[model samples]
Target: MTIKWEALLQVFGATLLVTVLVVTLFVIGIRALSDEKKGPAYASFAGCVAVVLYGLSLIVF
Candidate 1:
């Protein structure tokens, strides 16, 4: 069987991008909480959850 390098690279890039985005959002949320910024902290946590749910939906559906 032949491997599709292009497709593999595309998947790798997408995974890396998503991983960074999620981690960044989580970190921002933590920082916001520590700084006593409730609004931004909630928003950041929500963003992280949304991304995770989207990823799960992509895999499931």
Candidate 2:
């Protein structure tokens, strides 16, 4: 049986995108909790979670 490599590549790319999003949220959370420029950082962290979830929807379906 022959396996389709294109789907594999799509999955890999989506996975990488999700990783980047998670790391971005981590940085945002740290910066937000710190005593410097306390504003959009926290919101950004939340947004990151949403973004990752949205990305997963694409990968799963």
Clashes of each: 0, 0
Please provide, for model 1 over 1-61, each residue's C-alpha lDDT reduced to its tens digit, 9 standing for 90 to 100. Answer: 9999999999999999999999999999999999999999999999999999999999899
Model 2: ten consecutive residues of lowest lDDT: 35-44
Top-scoring candidate (lDDT): 1
Predicted structure 1: lDDT:
0.97
lDDT of 2 by residue, 1-61 (tens): 8888999899899789878878987787787778565576777777877887787798799
Q: Give every collision pair in model 2.
A: none
Clashing pairs in 1: none
Question: lDDT per model, in order?
Answer: 0.97, 0.80
- Badly placed stretches (over 4 Å) of model 1 are none
Q: Each model's TM-score, in the order given?
A: 0.97, 0.64
Best by TM-score: 1
